[model samples]
Every structure is written in C-alpha cells, then in structure tokens.
Target: MKLESNLPKQSPWLYTAPLLNTILLLLVYFLFTSDFVVQSGISVEHPESNSRLTGFDRAHIITVAAGTDSALYFDGLRISQPELREKLKANREGERRAIIHADKHAPHGRVIEIGNMALDLGYEVAYSTVPPKS
Candidate 1:
C-alpha cells in the first residue's frame, strides 16, 4: 500500500489583479463622482437646483464674462484663443471634464469655444446648468 501526498499551490498572492483593479475602480469612481476639491478663480453663483451637484477632477473652467468682447479668463488670468488651446493641451491628459459657466446674456459662441477647447484637449466635458427642481 502507498500513501499519496498532496501540497497546496504556492503564490497565494496571484489573484491580486482583480482586487487591485476593484480598488482602483472604486478610487476612480469615487474621485470622478465625488467633488471633494473646489476650483479657484471662477466667480459664478451656480444656479440653485435640486440636483445638488458639487464639482469634478481634472477640469478646466473658461468663464465668459458679460461683455461685448467676451473675454476669456482661465483660473483668473485673461487668455487668448490660441493660448487657451495651448494651455488646455498642456494641462489635459486625455480624460477630462469641463464645465462652462457663461453669463446668460453672453454670446453662445463663447461657450462653444470653451467646449471646443476642452474637446481638443481630449476631455469629457459637461455643461454646468441649473437643473430644474423635480
């Protein structure tokens, strides 16, 4: 009679990717959905609504003030169209989300320009608007 010996497989840490991926995904989910940081230099009293949304990560805000020229201010500094594009390109890292806050009276083209800039930077942009109360 002979007795067989059985040994458990080694490297129990092999199934780490799924757990790591899960942790990463959770971090990203929380980071993307939760607005923990407040962006500076933007001066718009975001309209009150029932949505109660806060903010985003890796976002570039282009404020179109109420004026005829429709000057552009990025982080409190005036920037031209070409320069704006350059800044967005340099700052963006493929995935992005931008919120446009334009004066209700401002030219629509101005907001489009901002969105275009974010698009050119490869960011997922979202327009910031006052959601109606449900």
Candidate 2:
C-alpha cells in the first residue's frame, strides 16, 4: 500500500535558497573584512615622511629590507649589489626611474649606496615612505 499527501509541491530552489543566501552573506562579510594590500616583492616597514612624491613609474623597483646580510631585493628577488648594478645597466633604456622601497630599520648607508648607484646610472631615484600619522 502507498500513501499520498494533499500538500502543495515545493520547487527545488526553495531548499537551496537559504544555503545560497548564507554563502552570499559569507562572501560579502569576508570581502568587507579582508585587508587588500597591493604590494609586490619583499615586505618592509617604510619610514614615515611628511613629503609626498607623485607621478613616478614602478618599472624598476629595488627593495632594501632590514638587516645587513642578503637584504637587497630587485624585482622581488634577493640580489647582491653587483647583480643589481648589472640588472640596472641592462634595463637602461626607456624611462630611467628607480623607486627604492627601503625598510625603516635597513642600513642607512646601504640605502644611500643603492640610491647612488641608481643616480650614477642616470636613473631618477625616489624613496618610498609612508605618510606621517596624524
């Protein structure tokens, strides 16, 4: 024997509506709560400065990380000063701009040396710095 009910039939979407809404809510929550940092290459704590520089290209970027050993990075790769010099020499064409993202704790002399190298190569050098806190 079989039993039959007189209840109305429900669409399949009725069962999945709650789940879809929950997934959508979770996606929206994560998107709003997440931090989107768009920096590439080695991470470093930039020093704060009151001055601001604008309209500089990032084709050539050198990162000077903290500590004295193996702290130089070019194009996201750890490189030596000599290797950096060679790379800069190779890309001497087009817009000659070198943006240096030096860590606040990095050796000041080393940062200056890198800047000098870029300057000697006839590339306009700019140091990356965070805006001063209010």
Best by lDDT: 2
Q: lDDT per prediction? A: 0.70, 0.85
Clashes of 2: 0
**Which has the greatest TM-score?**
2
Where model 1 places Cα greater than 4 Å from the true spot, the runs are: 1-42, 45-58, 92-95, 131-134
lDDT, model 1, position 117? 67
Q: For each candidate, what TM-score against the reference?
A: 0.55, 0.69
Q: Estimate, for each residue in 68-104, the C-alpha lDDT of model 1 and write its tens digit.
A: 8877777668888789788777774543666666766
Worst 10 residues of 1 by lDDT: 45-54
Cα lDDT, model 2, residue 32: 82
Question: Which residue pairs in candidate 1 collide?
Answer: 96-124
